[model samples]
Target: MSVIEEERVRGGVFKDINPEDEDQQPTVIESLCMNCYENGSTRLLFTKIPFFKEIIISSFTCPHCNWTNTEIQSAGRIQEQGVLYTLQVKTKEDMNREVVKSDSASTRIPQLDFEIPAFTQKGSLSTIEGLLDRAVAGLEQDQPIRKATDPAVAEKIEEFIERLKKLKKVEEEFTLIIDDPSGNSFIENPSAPQKDTALTVTHYKRTPEHNAVLGIETEEEEDDRKPVNDLDTMRNEVLVFNTNCPECNAPANTNMKLVQIPHFKEVIIMATNCDSCRHRTNEVKSGGATEELGTRITLHLTDPSDMSRDLLKSETCSVLIPELEFELGMAALGGKFTTLEGLLKDIKDLIVSKNPFMCGDSSTADRAGKLELFGQKIDKIIAGEMDVHVILDDPAGNSYLQNVYAPDPDPEMKIEKYTRTFEQNEDLGLNDMKTEGYAEK
Candidate 1:
């Protein structure tokens, strides 16, 4: 076995081993069976799932009582973000789709108002139908005792189990959701390289409660635990801190610095590098307070040389290109401080290469063609071959674009300030904010 495989064995789980090797069989040890209180043999097998991560499967069998139990656990590290998978089951074929539910994941059926809470059951690698079968088995397991004691409750549970069984028939449409704070669960996408229309996967940042449950500390918590001295002296220095790689979940270092733009306000730039995964990412954040009014900047691109202008797109900023009929929403790309050309390239990459459905077998010709054309137009804009107007709308009034004529107003660039609408303020979470008189209330 390789060193990596050996490490896995040391962690109480075996790595992938050749089945033909006589000495490389799965490790088996005597374990106490919970049901029979008898000695049982537990077999541990660690293997990789195709297109997924490593997992450990353990099976315990008590020969005396003929008791058996199987469970799966993810051998991979926790992910940087939580995942929510929504799969629509409309046909019998949908029941055959593969599903991997980690111990930290919760399963829900909206149509039936049923839920399996996290940590309530062991992790399993099964199909949709298999999940429903397990639910029915669990419900039926205690039905006999319940029927003898409480017939009323037993009748309701039996009726529910029948409804669950009916779901396997696909007589009605239903939605299955798997929400995993550890991001270890998965629902197979039947479309493969293409996007599955019936499946919607969303990744979100874990909340503080989730972090507490995971035993992960946030930067804020670290700061409170260890107070830094001389904040003024640290303003100009690059601050380095420990973090985990988002890609591989390995220990990494994040460097942050306060940078001041010559004509604009100060911003905090943070960059992280992972030695294990060789992954690097940098982002910018506005350091100043939100302005009283929103700012809209429009620049007409006429010369190719205009691509070199520096642009700071705040997290609250949206980008619009009227000629290309492209509108990017706020916080879509996070905060970025780069040249105009670089920003446009990033936008093209996001819409084309990074799009989940852009290059799959299920991608329609018309849809793909339009995205390709959109990419080409961006390239033209970057090369100065196309004349168009680019607008930066920031409701927080934090975005900035370089003015070629410093101190003097550029004729091609127009800047406008306007009061933000009530909806915009609400979206920014400013509607409920009480800056003063909070103690009085």
Candidate 2:
């Protein structure tokens, strides 16, 4: 670790302190859909705590589409009580770090949305709006603002975009502002690039609790966790149970409809059902992982040539990516030939390779031109639940669901059976024995 990192490892200003003395974290501006702009704020729970350098950033929700792209646009001085520090994060590779200042450096500060960082909460203040506005305005303008971009107006857009990417990454930095009985100031630009170095160290702070420290893993341990095929049998077997209808509580069944689906890799399951009351919601889940389908519709690539498939599998790394099986009927799968173009070249190649008639330039290119038709097919499958035409071998026809419906795995579960009984229950009759025949006599 570098000298500054060593200081941080020891704990800045917060050393020899109680866990209760944590400084208020900075806020991040989040949203629902990445593409949509917000007209008003929507209350939301933070999915996880965010950190900038060593400083932790707060979270907020957008009233719009619910995209969670939040960021720390300013140093935590307002929240830290008027003291500011320049805290440098690190290079993209996380090789070097520097703490240029610590609540004792600069006088000029970029304005922030929240006055008190501690009071930072939902509906209160936006942490990044002002800065975001400035950055976005600079982005919207055709001119460049800094020498970073020539001609000055459109120049900062790249920087803003880079910040968005960094926010997406776990690595972030906080500008620290602190306070003492006597008023003071400090500041530095941690965003500036760090010096190049060959030797590097990963940091792990020692906590009072013995469990805080993590040991370097042995090769054997790593080999055990190495990515392998995981099959969750319960994924498709569990009934699409719905408890939302006010009346009927039967299992809400979902038929796997494959409308012209050509590239089938991850089985896309859109979970839409209720088992208690009359409410239905849908979320996408892959066949390999747990069945907690999230709210994003996914497009899976079936190409064997690209590593993108594996990259997508380990969500630990981001490459964005979906599936379903049919038991009762033949499946037809396809999509607008055009959407395939945006996918990796391998997937596009798979499409053309399978449909030989679509081979070569203009002839195949003509096929690629029909995005509207492909979209309709996908809509029919996803929206209309239309089954796709697929080849299958079912001699016994056991999958026809006629032989065995499997009867909703453990259908008759009493929710309260596993819970602990209240102490009042056992003593109820004895203590209230004055009840039955004698009122208050």
Which number leads on TM-score? Answer: 1
Clashes of each: 0, 58
Q: Please provide, for model 1 over 208-252, each residue's C-alpha lDDT reduced to its tens digit, 9 standing for 90 to 100.
A: 988888778776533445665765665779999998665455667
Question: What's the lDDT for residue 274 in model 1?
Answer: 80
Predicted candidate 2 versus true structure: per-residue lDDT over 4-74, tens digit per residue? 33333333411221235445223234334445765433332221111111222234455666655433222
All candidates: CA RMSD (Å): 7.2, 26.0
Over 4 Å off in model 1, which ranges? 1-207, 217-235, 249-251, 274-277, 322-325, 358-370, 418-441
Evaluated at residue 298, the lDDT of candidate 2 is 25
lDDT of 2: 0.28
The C-alpha TM-scores of every prediction are: 0.60, 0.18
For candidate 1, the TM-score is 0.60
